[model samples]
Target: MPKLMNVRVTTMDAELEFAIQQTTTGKQLFDQVVKTIGLREVWFFGLQYVDSKGDLTWIKLYKKNEPNNCAGQIMQKLFQPNELEIYPTKVMSQDVKKENPLQFKFRAKFYPEDVAEELIQDITLRLFYLQVKNAILSDEIYCPPETSVLLASYAVQARHGDYDKTTHAPGFLSNDRLLPQRVLDQHKMSKDEWESSITTWWNEHKGMPREDAMMEYLKIAQDLEMYGVNYFEIKNKKGTELWLGVDALGVNIYEKDDKLTPKIGFPWSEIRNISFNDKKFIIKPIDKKAPDFVFFAARIKINKRILALCMGNHELYMRRRKPDTIDVQQMKAQAREEKIAKQQQREKLQLEIAARERAERKYQEFEERLKAMTEDLAKREQDLQNAEDKIRALEEQVKLQQQAREELEARQNELQEMMIRLEESKNLEAAERQKLEDEIRAKQEEVKRIQTEIEIKNEHTRRLEMEVEEARQKKEEANRQLLAVSTTPQHHHVEENDHDENDDLPNGDVTKDLEIDSSIVDPVEERRTLAEKNERLQDQLKALKQDLAQSLDETKETAMDKIHRENVRVGRDKYKTLREIRKGNTKRRVDQFENM
Candidate 1:
């Protein structure tokens, strides 16, 4: 097959984050995950092949594109319409039958277990954290402009980019712990530091606070959890006015457990006394592995502004706490509302898309219709040309036929004239008389010879056929007797099913007519006529018989007796039911060893 140049090879990755925390590996990982999730049945169907040239010739998988051998076999398996696009790719994939160093990364698709719904919140949170970590390690994440809201922390004052309310500073925003103080000075104030300053102002005026600033700030922090933010703090609803800060991955939420006494969860659970004078907390986990707690610290913003303060637990007094972290039902409802809104937007867009598609389709159809009309016009024109040619050829044939007919008529007339003259003459030359007599004698001799040979062969062939047939009948009868003897033991169980109705009985008069007509079977015309005649005679006989036996016609026959006539009908139709084939078990079970 000739190769075509139009082929595309692109790689795509599965966009889903891990369903469970797993070390990514081979098929077992997916299998284990799916098993853990509990899916009932899974069937995967796809052609997996790599293209040596990185060109997918999946089109060859289709019947039209298939080479003589394995073509179309795989296509029939998948049978997806979009599979047409992949067929060319499949063919190209054959080029990679041998291992190639080139490897293609592909996306994974999830065919979730039955009844599983999307856990958007769960999945998104994990992915966001992974992205942040990857970006930190790779540094290819984002280099946002200084005007970016995230850059407004007081720790890194305006040295460039786009933070509006800051100076190109030589001093660093004191709280940035990651970068050197000098490098920190090169960037602008982060939003968290500025927000902390605002919170401090709000605290100073707590007696005359403009609004419920503290409560609102708490609410914002709570909402941030839903936005993939892990770090969170609670101001005493009554204590800390509003101190906003970031921790280096450790957070101490001041609260009370069931005892209503201060019970704080922190990295340093055993520390007798601890305090944060510098407001910088570095969480060094003591467990075997990193603790599963949401390594809560990432980035921070206070009062819609940046700050450079990191927080840690400063041992302090606390109060009993009763809290609702998440409301599942309300969250579901909110998600549903958002989904509906999105659906409406999508549907409206889809309507526009569909309308445009319909218009395009109609235009395409019109174009095709026009092309068809043009083709039809061309066909009709060609047909007309052919008709004209045929007419000319037929005229020539007619003229030739007419000429031949005229010559034949002329010859016939001449023959008639000669015959008339010959009949009237009555006298013949002696030589001519002798020649006629000799010709008649020769013809008569030839006819006798043919008749004699034909008679002899006919009798001999018939006699030989008769003897052969008789011998064949005897042999067949003997074979049947032997078979019946062999089968006798098996039949003993159903001794009743043993008659020859197959040979003796048929539907109404159909059997008798068939038998009577068999004699003439070698001649189709005679056989049909004989069968019809027998049928008429049988019908008359049946009517007479029925009239005589009308009183006894109601007698019922038992099914067992019918079976006793074992030469019964085996219908082709019964083969449609599998159970009918099962009936052959008895015959198959019975075996006889025959030896000469």
Candidate 2:
């Protein structure tokens, strides 16, 4: 076999992922570059070969690296660009070898993301055309005619991309806009000749395929993220351009009711008289009447920045155009509608918060009031229990007094009977009387001393007035004293005069004591006197205890109430801060997020 072209193939540059992910043209070019140079080891931009003419021949550009081992031909040439846009930086090509004479360089920058698909279709179709150009000139038929037809279809597909005006293809695959040169290069024609041929073919097939406009429109909206509240601007109906000031805010136009409208940034009345540079122009709304231009606007306020929008719908709107105030007014109406919607949402949330707050306040009030009331009720029930106990003690005293009175009456009746029996024994009875009289004399003397002691105790009680707590204890002791008096010898002596000690007796005392001989003193009366003395002393002690506890409790409660008032002040301040946070009237949360 004849010596094949000796060369080395290599790809060197940045990673292919980013470049391939960019424009489709870049991806296609990368692939072709890989196959033509790397896979085939055909490192040359164009191949050199001898034709069947028995003479060396030069041919036009070729797209593929077909072998020239048989009686075929080889072409040498690479595609060129008609226009060159200048860029600030230079780009080093990926595939550069020391032996290769061609300089791999680029002086133009492109937004590969925005126009990736268009670039891919353009490069692919042009290469297909170049392939056909080579075949027609050199008479190579290795590939079928249907392949050429398909390439032609691809070029046509590219021309009607992004909402085709002539085709019915759907989905992302059909968004191409170009005419492949392969269809015209079958006869070895240049792109100029190929374009003229396409014009002739388009005249034959202009209205044959109807396009789906709505599908394309929706795809465009989705691509732009209109659902995310993006804003834009464009020109108005008249022709005037504020070229430099337009795209600053980076806003967009919105669609409503089958019409394009600009969102009003704020209420116009607040912003109308203000110039574009004024900081107070925050009240702009969207303009919804199909826009002619989209302007990106910004107004600075209080050392902060805010975004604003203006947009146009028609293609003509991008040209030198004047804005529509009428459309702006329409936008105000639209803004009002949007404002009403937002207000309704806010109002719903506000009402829920208010209701919850009211409920919480009411519950707190109820709980506090309940605590106070329950405490009071417990105290009252205790007092009632004390009263009930006192009433029971009083009833017991009355019952004991009644029994004592009945017993005394029975004793008197028995004495009367016994006296009558004594009278029958006249002389002996006289002796008994004499003995009784002597005993009475001794009791009278004892009574005089006891009375003196009582006077002294009463004088002491008068001087020492009981405190409230002491008084309560004193009252209990007094009740005991009154009980004691019911069983006392002193109570029997005086029926009507109960004194304070004998208060438990019936309104009138019934017990009466007879003058008794010391030799025959009744043990019951002696026991009663001792009990009364003990009760009187106990009453005084109880009164002192009651007064002490009441005074202490009152002082402690006063101190606690003062502390509670101070705590309420702190609670109110904390609650106020929480209220502002919930209402979003403060920027605390925003600041927190910014700091993070």
Q: How many collisions per candidate?
A: 44, 54
lDDT of 2 by residue, 375-477 (tens): 6556555655665665555556556555655655565565556556555656566678766555545554554555555455444434333333444575566
Total clashes, candidate 1?
44
lDDT of 2 at 562: 43
The 10-residue segment of model 1 with minimum total lDDT is: 587-596
Top TM-score prediction, candidate number: 2
lDDT of 1 by residue, 1-596 (tens): 34232222222212222321222222433344335333322121112234455533221222234444432111121111432332222333334334322222221111111111222232322222233323322322221121111222211221122222334232333333322232223334453543443233223222211111222222222222111112233233233322222222122332221111112233223122212212222232333233222211122222111111121111110100123125644555666787677767756666566669777886787677567656655655565555555555555655655565565556556555655655554588767656655654555565455555545655654555565555556555555654554343552242233434554645433232212454543232343343574466346445533432332222332332233122124432211322332233221211100000
How does residue 216 of candidate 2 score in lDDT? 21
Residue range with the least summed lDDT across 10 consecutive positions in model 2:
105-114
The per-model lDDT (C-alpha) reads 0.32, 0.33
Reference-based TM-score, model 1: 0.21
Model 1 residue 38 distance off true place after TM-score fit, in angstroms: 51
| Predicted structure 1: lDDT | 0.32
Report lDDT (Cα) of residue 476, candidate 2.
69
